[model samples]
Target: MTKITFVQQDGVRIDTEAENGSTVMETAIMNGVPGIVAECGGACTCATCHVYVDNDWTEKVGGPSMMEEDMLDFAFDVKEASRLSCQIKVKDEFDGLVVHVPGRQG
Candidate 1:
């Protein structure tokens, strides 16, 4: 299992263990982390699972695909590091990944 920390815009933090190969959004939702509604259930169709990857972890987390990129445009606070959590698969290398949730999530 890998540990993933989720920091909300309000500074609230949620640290949880994620199984390798699972999406970060799945881990967040399963652990009841606020700010990640995951209304579409990891489908990359909804922007509800939006999160900002910490700068230091960006290269490891990687960028979103064209479809995810297009969906992120509809997020509340889109940033260069913005990513749809559903599209991010957790790996052993992401053991200490840190992500920030936006203030608002639809």
Candidate 2:
């Protein structure tokens, strides 16, 4: 399992365990992370699951795909580290991954 940390908009931090191969959004939503609404489930159709990969972890987390990039266009406060959680698959290397949840989902 990958140990992922979610920093909420309010600055609250949550630590959750994610199964390898599961999407980040799934792990977040399943563990009840407050800021990830995930309105479109894991379809990459909605920007509700937008998160900012931690500066240190950004390169490893990588960027979104074309489809996910289009969806992220609808997210609020988009940043260089912005990513659709659903599009990010959890992996062993992702252990200790840190992400920040936006204040609102666009």
Candidate 3:
């Protein structure tokens, strides 16, 4: 299992253990991390699971795909680090990944 952290808008942090193949969004939902609504599940359709990859992990997490980038257009407060958690697959390399949840979904 890999460890991932979700930082809520209010600055609350939720730490969780995620399966190797699961997405970060799944980890958040399973751990009941508030602010990650995942309205479209992991389809990469809705941006409700949008999050900002922590500066330290942005490069490792990489950028969004073209399709995901399009979906991110619907996310609130899009930033250089903005990403759809559903698109981020958890892996051993992501053992300490951290993401910030927005105040609202777009």
State the lDDT of candidate 3 residue by residue for 1-106, as single tens digits: 8999899888889999999999999999999998899998989988999999999999998999999999998998999999999999999999989899999996
Model 2, span 1-106: residue lDDT tens = 7899999878889999999999999999999998789998999888999999999998888888989899988999999999999999999999999999999987
TM-score ranking from best candidate downward: 3, 2, 1
How many collisions between residues are there in candidate 1? 0
Which window of 10 residues has the lowest lDDT sum in candidate 1? Answer: 69-78
TM-score of every model versus the real structure:
0.96, 0.97, 0.98
- Segments in model 1 whose C-alpha atoms lie over 4 Å from true places: none
Q: Which candidate would rank higher by TM-score, 1 or 2?
A: 2
Give lDDT for model 1: 0.92
Q: Which stretches in model 3 have alpha-carbon errors above 4 Å?
A: none
Kindly report which residue pairs in candidate 1 clash with one another: none
Candidate 2: how large is its RMSD?
Answer: 0.7
Off by over 4 Å in 2: none
Candidate 2 minimal-lDDT segment of 10 residues: 59-68
Backbone N/Cα/C clashes per model: 0, 0, 0
lDDT of 1 by residue, 1-106 (tens): 8999999788888999999999999999899998899989988888999999999999988899999989987898699999999999999999999999998986
